[model samples]
Target: TPPDPGDRIPTGFADLDTLTSGGLRPGRMVVVGARPGVGKTLVGTGLARAAAIKGGLPTLFKTLEMGDEE
Candidate 1:
């Protein structure tokens, strides 16, 4: 069956979109974790840029070391 267009937020990466069956679904969580200085922030920013900019959707990138006031 074809995926519902409204159900996805394009990951911007072709491979990611394929692996995710179009893109990340609404109301789901995706975790990218690793040790210090391992490009975790790069990955997070890439996703956020893809969704919020190219894909024109709201995006959030949270960190354990920072908060709304930081």
Candidate 2:
């Protein structure tokens, strides 16, 4: 299905768009660097979830740190 003109766009990061021209565009790569346990994966997951839930776009997540518990 095609996107509706009245649809809302997900900015991924709510606080980020205020500083940039809208927000990250689709099919673009964003490199984020931070110390371990600083929520890098969490942020990525959150963005994917936001796009899926809020924007009605399908999201994919690949975790290199997967374990048997997952």
Candidate 3:
């Protein structure tokens, strides 16, 4: 089953959560766009970490730019 969209999942960053209006809502789309070397992957993995580790929620993160060998 999927998580309830009504509840929010914290991003593990207080500032981010605050900016996002109490974290991110489930079953919603979010896009983080920026230039290279600007910590885009850092932010993405952080959210995945928070959801999987802290929030105990199911998450899947795929990167088109990197491979397992990279």
Candidate 4:
């Protein structure tokens, strides 16, 4: 069955869901900024993976720093 629009968005992290009173709100942007050596790419890739591969939602990732591998 398809997920309902009124249903909650899963954080994919149980602990985070409890802390955030549910999960990330729709139409919200999450920005992760750092001075390099951080895991920004990893997190972004993870989100894309969850949305596309896991949640079955279409995803688009545009990277200016790296070239596409596939």
Which of the numbered candidates is closest to the native, going by highest TM-score? 3
* Candidate number with greatest lDDT: 3
lDDT of each candidate versus the true structure: 0.79, 0.66, 0.82, 0.61
Full-model lDDT, candidate 4: 0.61
Order of all candidates by TM-score, from best down to worst? 3, 1, 2, 4
Q: lDDT by residue for model 4 over 1-70, one digit each (tens)?
A: 7655455444556686677666555555656566665776776676666656655667665555566773
Clashing pairs in 2: none
The candidate 3 region of ten consecutive residues with least summed lDDT is: 61-70
Ten contiguous residues with the weakest lDDT in model 1:
1-10
What TM-score do all the candidates reach, one by one?
A: 0.70, 0.63, 0.79, 0.56
Quote the positional error of residue 54 for candidate 4 in Å. Answer: 3.0
Error of 3 at 69 (Å): 2.0
Positional deviation of 43 in candidate 2, in angstroms? 0.2
- Model 1 lDDT on a 0 to 1 scale: 0.79
Model 4 CA lDDT for position 13: 60
* Candidate 3 clash figure, as a count: 0
Tens-digit per-residue lDDT, 1-59, candidate 1: 65454688777779989998888886667788999778877877888888898768788
